[model samples]
Target: MKAEFATAERAVTLGVRETTDGLKMSMRRQVTSAGLGQRMANTWRGDNYPKGQNSIRAAGVVYTKASRIMEGFEDAAVIRSKDGWWLAIPTPNAPKRGVGGKRINPSNFPEHTYGRLRFVYRSGKPSLLVVDNARASYNRKSGQLRGFRKASDRAVSKGSGLTTVVMFWLVPQVQLPRLITFNTEAKRWFDRLPQLILKNWPD
Candidate 1:
């Protein structure tokens, strides 16, 4: 999960007596800038920026640790549950944040904060985790169903507005489509190598 650029080869081509350290620093800046641009593009969810650290310089080579995530943009990826269990896909009604302000999943979901959840199986469709006697209210600002509250006995009675609200969908696998322009950005920065070397040429 890395991209390595041999700085020595480019430095040789440019006939520069500058140190590889200078060129490596220049390349690091460009790679950092490129990563920032991708983050701004809003291709994926959450803050994927720091998940992959900035580029590193080693022995005349500059590389990045963002390969695994960037590779998904180059090709489609099928993600399966790590524990051989169904993947819980959160629904709009599900809480967005869990403990430590991270995205909520079945593992870290605050069930007690919401209500008791039950599984509902479907004959031909994915099974769902739902709250039987809960009510959901929509938030106009976020455009999502939030404010899940337990229904009182009278509210759960007939003609009551309380209904089963879906929290998550259980699926075996999920296929992620190609979204980011990783190769394009890589080539762009690669093409600028000559200029970068000159810019950071040893003073």
Candidate 2:
């Protein structure tokens, strides 16, 4: 939500011999960067998707700090640091009692909803791949304990008949990233720039 820019010194080869038309490449770079930033921002906002885009559909860690995109020009982008971990977890709505009124363990539930976690990094170094259950819920307000849910105190249950049960617990679920789509969209945005700049260029 805030406008922030992080400068990344990338080696750019304009790919053309020196000429009076160097402006074309420079314009291309700027437009490309802006396009990429907008695409990434849209993804973060969960736009341009259909059918339960907000649903948590898998269990496990899908993203970490290292996987974060590090820089953008007009929108906020993740800054690389040895200080925190970002995790994606999938959680389902709730589960009901099975046969014989037996309480099902939350772990056995098929996770179809997703959320994310941000963890504070400790020690002189931090890891991007270290996943420990004890450390996973290291956040003070993560997960559930006893009969208390950290996210919501109200108990809600779904389903009816012999499948009715109370909604309980939250756990990690995973969501896949659309890196390919990001690249495609970014390229499409960038592809239109030449004509745009030519139209704006002085006669």
Candidate 3:
């Protein structure tokens, strides 16, 4: 007599689906633990280190709006101005973004609000946009300069405790350092994928 074996096709399919779900869950947990979520939030909101939302997962892919920034931290990258002009690196004295997220530059800076900005050239060094006779406003608790106070005509004429404040530093390019071990972190989680699948195996 001969014996024949039949495959449990439905059970096999269910097992595979369960394993996939578990792997996805594990990946989401690992990504959250990596602190990328907070980084993305900070980048988007222009805030200093706050709790962030979870990463977006779609069709078996994980990503975020700050993905390019995260990738830049994986390796040294050079950033330059898009207009072939000097990059305007903001200083403590620079005004914050204007209405509608418009960048405060020399051309568009609200002169009425912060006084006129003057350009200062330096030999073999980055140039600067400065405000004369202006005082910097600082946070009382943090002591961080928020913006420059527009100096009155009287103050400029009298030079009454007046000071020059650097608003923006103009540079051709800036180099970013490798700040994150992206591949290493991903590999650490990837190596454990088999375990994740096994743990999720259907009963």
TM-score of each: 0.57, 0.22, 0.64
**Which lDDT tens digits does candidate 2 get at residues 1-203?**
12111111010111111111233333334444555444433333211112322211211111112224422322344333233423322223233442345543333432222111223344543312211111112345765532212221122222211111223322232233323333443454356534443443344
Q: Write the per-residue lDDT of candidate 3 for residues 63-119, one digit (tens) a residue.
A: 335668756655768999899989888885676774346986667777677777788
Q: What is the C-alpha RMSD of each candidate to the true structure, in Å?
A: 9.8, 20.7, 8.8
The worst-scoring run of ten residues by lDDT in candidate 3 lies at 46-55
Cα lDDT computed for each candidate against the true fold: 0.60, 0.28, 0.60
Backbone clashes, candidate 3: 0
Q: After superposition, how far is residue 184 of candidate 2 from its true place, in Å?
A: 1.1
Candidate 2 lDDT at 91 equals 24
RMSD to native, candidate 2: 20.7
How far in Å is the alpha carbon of 80 misplaced in model 3?
1.2
Clashing pairs in 2: 56-112, 56-113, 56-114, 57-112, 57-113, 58-174, 89-173, 90-173, 90-174
Pairs that collide in candidate 1 are: none
Candidate 3 overall lDDT versus native? 0.60
